[model samples]
Target: MERSVIHNLIAALPVAVVAVDHEARVSAANVAASALLGENLTDRPFVTVLRHPVVVQAVDAVLDPAHVSLPVPDPTLAAVGSGGYRNRVIISARGRDIPAEVTVSALPDRIGALVVIEDSSGIEEAEQQRRDFVANVSHELRTPLTAMIGFIETLRGPARDDAAARDRFLSIMETEAARMNRLVMDLLSLSRVESEERRRPAEAVDLTMIIGAVVATLTPHAEAHNVNISLIGAENEALVTGDPDQLTQVFHNLVENAVKYGGSGGEVRLELSRIRHEPALRGPAIAVAVIDRGEGIDEMHLPRLTERFYRVDNHRSRQQGGTGLGLAIVKHIIGRHRGRLRIESVKGQGSRFTVILPAKRDRR
Candidate 1:
C-alpha cells in the first residue's frame, strides 16, 4: 500500500523488475532492472526507457487508464487482458541482443503495473547446441549408410551376375560398415568422457611406459608406411596422477595421427620433457610431444583442432579412418587430468602435438 514498501518488494525480486505508475512513468526499478535496461530508469517514461514497441504496448495495456495507445497485434505479447500481459522478446544489453521474457501484471489498489524481465540466453544457447549436435550425428551416420545401401543393391542385382564385381562391392560395403561402427564407438566414448570430465583422475601412472607400449603396438603400422617412430626420454621416468586408460588413449590418438598425417616425412618422433613450471598448469608438469616431419598443417586450422568433428582435410581424415572425434576426446581427457594439449606446426616442417600433465609429486 505504501510507495516505499512497493519499491522494497520490487527491489527484493531476484530478476529484473520495473514498476510503472498509472501515469506511465517508471515509478520503481530494481538494481537488476537498471543493469538490464539502463541506469537512471526511475521517474522516466516507461516507453522511453524500454523502447521496444511490443514491451511498451504490454505495459500500456496493464496501465490502460493512462490513455496510452496500443500498437498493432504483436506475436511477442502473449496476453494483454485484465489480469496481466506476458511476453517473450529480444532486448539489447551491453551491445548484444539477448532473449528476454517480460511479464506485466497489474498491481492491486492501482499502485502501478509490475514488469519483470528474465534473461533466457543460456537456455537458448544450450538448446541450439543440442540441435546442432543431433544434426551433425545424423549427417555423419547417413553418409556411410547411404554408401552401404548402394553397394548392397548392386550386389543384389547387377553384381550378382559377376563374381569379381560382387567381391569388390562387398569389400566396399564392409569398409562403409566399419566406418559407421567407428563413428558409433567414438560417439559413445565422447559421451562418457564429457560426463566425467569434471572429476579428476587420481591413480598414479608412468607416461613413458604408456607411450612405449603405444609405440610398440603402432610400430608395424609405421613400418608399413616407411615411417620411423623414435621415442625420446624413454629411459627417464615421469609419473602423474591420472587415468591410465584415458592417458593411453590420448597418446594413441596423437601418435597415430602423426604417423598417419605426417608419416610422409619418414619420421614420427615421440619426445618427452619435463616442465619445471607450466604456467598454464601453475606447477611442475611433464610434457610429451608427438612430433612429425611430414607436411604440416596451416596456421588457420590450428585453433579449432579440439572442436568436435572439426577436420582440416575432411576427405583425407575419412580415408585415414579417423572419427574426427579423436582430438576432441583427447582434449576432454587431458582436461579431466587438469592438463593441456599444445599444437604447433608449420606449413612445410610438419606438426607437433604435445600433452602436458601435472606430474605426481613423489615417485614410487
Candidate 2:
C-alpha cells in the first residue's frame, strides 16, 4: 500500500499507531504515535524506536509470512479478531519505560504491519491504588481486633481471679474496641463524601454559626488538653452554599485536630473572613482558617495532608484517636461546595488550614 494511504488510514485512529513497510522500516506514524514514541518516528528503524523482542517478532511475523514466528491463534484475540497479534510490552518512550498493549496486524498483500499501541499507565496505577487501600484497611482493623482478642483471653484465664487486673484489662479492651469503631465510622464517612462529591450542595448554610457551634463542642476537649479554642470574626452571619451537617463535620475535624496535635502552644483559633475575588473560587467567597499556635508541621507533609489515611506521626495519631481520614473528608466536602483548601506551614511557625468556599453557587 502507498505510504500516504497508510498515513491517511492510521491517522483516523484515536490511539497511537505506527506502520512499517515491507522493508521493516517505519513508513508512516500518526500524531498520537509520534507523541507517545517521540519525534521523527517516520522512516526510523522500528526496532530502534521499540526494541522489545516480542514486539519485533510480532512485526516480523506480520511482515513476512515465512518468518519463524508466524501468527498463532490466541483465545484472548477474540476481542481483536484472528487477524491481529496482541502483546503487553514496555516500550521506552522519551527516556521512560511505558507500559502499553500493542496489537500488530498484517496489511493485505504483505505490504507491512500496522502496530496499535494503547497506554496502560493509568489503568495500572488505579489498580495498584485499589490494592493499597484494601491492604491499609485490613491492617487498621486487624491491629485493634488482635489486641482485644488477646486481652479477652487473658481476662478469661489468669486475670479472672484478680479484680484489679480485670478492671484494667476491661478498660484497655474498651479503648481498643472504640478504636475499631472509629476506623469503621471514618471509612463510612469517607465513602459517603466521595459518593456525594460531584453533587453541589444547594442549601445556603450559615458558616459563622457552624464555626461557633464547633468551637463550643470542642472547647471542653481543648481545655482538657490545656488548649484554648476560640472563634474570631464570627460576629456577623456568613452564608455559603453547602450542607450544614458536612460543614459542621469539617470544622469539627479541623478544631479537634488543632486541639489534639497543635495544642502545645495552648491556643487554636478559627479566623473567618470574606474575600471579594478569590482566584481559586472564581468570585467573592468566604474563607474559614483553622490556625494553631503550636509547633508547626514540616513543609513536606502539607501537600499530602488531605490524602486518605495519611498521618505525619502514626503513633501520635493513633494515641490521639485520629483515624487519618478527617482531612480527606474535609477536602471532599469543600470540593462539593466548589471550594478549595489551602495549607500553609513552617517548621516552627505553626500551620494554617484555610477552607475557601464560593459565596454563590454556579447556576450556568
Best by lDDT: 1
State model 2's lDDT.
Answer: 0.87
Steric clashes per prediction = 0, 0
Give the Cα-based TM-score of candidate 1 against the true structure.
0.85
Clash pairs, candidate 1, are none
Question: Residue pairs in steric clash, candidate 2?
Answer: none
Residue-level lDDT for 265 in candidate 1? 98
Model 1, position 357: C-alpha lDDT score: 94
lDDT of 2 by residue, 182-202 (tens): 989989999998999999888
lDDT per residue (tens digit) for residues 1-364 in model 1: 6668889998888999988888889889999998888899889998887777788877777777466655556667666556587888888776789898989889886668998999999999999989988888898899988888888888888887899988888888888889889999999999999999999887889998999999999999999999999999879888999999988899989988999999999999998999899999999999999999999999999999998889999999999898889999999999999998899999999999989999889656
Instruction: Please list the C-alpha lDDT of all candidates, in the order they appear.
Output: 0.88, 0.87
Instruction: List where candidate 2 sits over 4 angstroms from the true fold.
Output: 1-13, 68-79, 108-110, 361-364
**Alpha-carbon deviation at 3 in model 1, angstroms:** 8.2
